[model samples]
Target: MRRVLLCLALFFASPLLANSKTLFLNGVYAATYGDIAWDKGDWRGSNFSAIRLKAGIQVVRIDFVSLTLGFQKVGFYSGMHKWSGDNDIGFDYRGPVLELHLFPDAPFGFSFAGATGTGYSYLTSASQYHYSSCEGCKIDAERSALKVGEFTAYVTYKISSQLEILAGAGTRSVKGEIDYDVDRGGVHSWEKGDVDSWKESNTMVLLGLRGSTL
Candidate 1:
């Protein structure tokens, strides 16, 4: 009986024994999906898709605004498939990322935030294209230096004093490369073709459940 009373006392006193800041950490399950159009060639319009794991930190007790910094690991899959024969090609892109956050109190006392970041991506695999009447072509190259950018907006709702639920949407742009081999037909001496600085952008939707103890 004495131990139960002592525990109750500690529970009541715990609120007064705490610090000022509320440190929050959350995991976001995100997916980016969108379409990309190309203007310089006879290629089909490309569509982009990506999956990422993102994390963030938020401070508490601030009235007007709060800040957050985030990190992500993104994996990308993209390609253009030709309609003739088996001339199909694709690229797998992987990367590490960093992000900035700006959270503000909106008109209804709700939280809204924006984010942007850079990512360094590496090309993981390349597949060769083969046609029925023409010789097969292979373009294998590994590239690890690419640029990334993002913009996000979110709404956060407090479930309790120590937990919150976040739902948001954002746009992400990642760079990649596509190489086309022009030597298969033997009609042109171009040998190889390069599509440098190729960019893919997608719209992302995410949900996060966070717990805080700061």
Candidate 2:
């Protein structure tokens, strides 16, 4: 029993001890702009904002090369207005990120990194539309969904040992189906079946800060 307990304790403690060797964490804020093209619909070009957080191991010499896993949240102000007009809709996405960075050893070092991930895209809005051929009669409804695939590439400047700033561009692609129903004044109307599979690819520019514990 004593030997078994010792083995179990060491097994759990091994990861914690290894994690103490080196830790890296960073955060970024950026603005993105580009075009979102749809296969079965129209294309939209717009600007968006994002915030990212990363944590991983240094794995190499300080500021040299490292692999990090992170998460980013993006907000789109008017990207969805083109779909449903005057609805005051909001669009956003959140996802897991994987990044690789290579930094040269210098004061004004220039670094390059690329990141990619998959996430969910959310849309919210309220609007009224004509129900069937009823005169002056309308129905109200809301819509939303989950999307996938986001990619980015960036160039960074190392200002100090623990801080860096970066600017980059990236794109997000999503395809999904949406369906809904509407009710008008005690009368129920169903808009059944798949409306249309929408495919969107948004391009954006990002400017953000990265701070770390080296």
lDDT of each: 0.38, 0.44
Across 33-132, the per-residue lDDT of candidate 1 in tens digits comes to: 1111111111114333333334444433245544444344343323222333322323232333333223333322233334344433333234332222
Best by lDDT: 2
Task: Kindly report which residue pairs in candidate 1 clash with one another.
Answer: none
| Candidate 2 similarity to native, TM-score | 0.54
Leading candidate by TM-score: 2
Global CA lDDT computed for model 2? 0.44
Can you give the lDDT of residue 177 in candidate 1? 43
